[model samples]
Target: MNQPNTPTRVRAVLADDERLMREQLRSRLTEVWPDLDIVAEAKNGLEAVELVREHRPDLVFLDIRMPGLTGVDAARQIAQLPEDDSWLVPEIVFITAYDQYAVEAFEQGVADYVLKPAERERLLVTVQRIKKRLAQRQDGASVPDVAEPAGAPLQQLLHKLSGQLNPGAKPNYLQWIQATVGQAIQMIPVEDVLFFISDEKYTRVQTARIEALIRKPIKELVDELDPSLFWQIHRSTLVNARAIDGITRDFRGRQMVGVKSLSEKLEVSRSYTHLFKGM
Candidate 1:
């Protein structure tokens, strides 16, 4: 008879500003995911990022808001770690108190999240999902590198949350883009931009009247553009929502967006299909 295989141990780190919250989460995780090893704990977002860099654990549970650095900011840094470090980016499960970030979280396709106080049932679901994802990755699945601009959705979510929290503070979104057209610099109103597509070196700006190129990439543009006006349909593409006429499916069932004024069709990646689910 063949011997049974032993289950692989999963390593994890828990980061929260409050000591009590960290203890409570650890206790709950122990009850739910017994195989999960708590390798380290952090008291702040900055500490959390450092811990991740040192341990490169399989998972990280981060408080959405922490002292010094926010969890979203920490995750951003962790996702952009240098490849030379040879660290596998850990799966992130944000622990949040606010319900407003839920939609944004789902839009980012995050691994999982646990509500504050850490309920056993919810943690179980998260644990199960993490296990499935880990197995898939171990089986040679083609997972995208975490340290890529594909995380722009999370950045946009963070920006929205910050604006909501500040209340009185209004973000200065880019109203116009200055692009060099031959020898003259032309100021193009952001509202007039139909879409932006980035290649290796530059981003192509398109409008009904003109097409121009800029040095700014889609990642940088995502921060400056108004989230309400633009939707990131792909890693290298951001389309003005007002310009989107409709979404259609190709012969292979891929989602494609038709622009109202432009004749070009935009291909939507599977990762961003959630943006057009209703359509």
Candidate 2:
């Protein structure tokens, strides 16, 4: 970690497969901290490692999960570089959209971490600390514990892992999904659904506007909704995007995705706007 006032130039490398996440992160990092130079950026772990060796940056901000090798695997490779390896050991900061590492990032010796939708203030704070740590390392100072916040993040990650392990083998995006209403259960094809609305407790699956209450949460239902056609307009609703006639904002300026086959309109949250990439 470099001293806060040190004259050191920070060399960095960034990695993520999602083009938006990667480009945005790099652009923001460059804009905010002009002293830092980004040597390379990669779309996957293998590329990241290759870049790491090529550039030998002083720090790396990495996304842990990628198609080929995980961020952790890349970290291990960084950790295992032989003494004769010409590159100096660089510090690591992790970034993730999933809450999977909110706890583990801290537990590990990682320099820092930022959750998705990182704020400018947070980025400034993180960058300062990283530079400070690098300065301290160069000055032969002891590294302080930058452990993660305990308990809650870990619990959330465990729950997520369990959910993934048990993510119903029966994918929700099927043309038909199992439904139970007042002890009468059956599989309902998507074509049968008139619309879906989120209630405080459960999502109401309506067919022809006759509501059938189901216990499945909307988050899980998002996966069930066909990504290619169905869209989650709001946290409370999932609408068949293809079925959408037009989108209009309501009296409050909140956007709604309206369907052609049904009068009931659904909300579209900003976070899910990406689902409409082409449409």
By lDDT, the best candidate is 1
lDDT of each: 0.75, 0.62
Across residues 1-279, which tens digit of lDDT does each residue of candidate 1 receive? 432222388889899999999999999999987878999999998999899888878789888889888887777666544323233567778888876664556455543578887889978877776775565344423245332213334446667666655669888999999986777779999999999998889899999888888999887787788877888777778999889998888897778999987778998754355455445
Give the TM-scores of the predictions, in the order they appear: 0.68, 0.49
lDDT of 2 by residue, 198-232 (tens): 66687788776455777887656654555445544
RMSD of every candidate to native, in Å, equals 6.9, 17.8
Q: So what's the TM-score on candidate 1?
A: 0.68
Q: Give the per-residue Cα lDDT of candidate 1 at 161.
A: 60
> Residue 206's C-alpha lDDT in candidate 2?
74
Q: Which parts of model 2 have CA positions greater than 4 angstroms off?
A: 1-7, 83-87, 107-109, 143-279
Off by over 4 Å in 1: 1-14, 18-20, 34-60, 75-92, 98-113, 125-156, 251-253
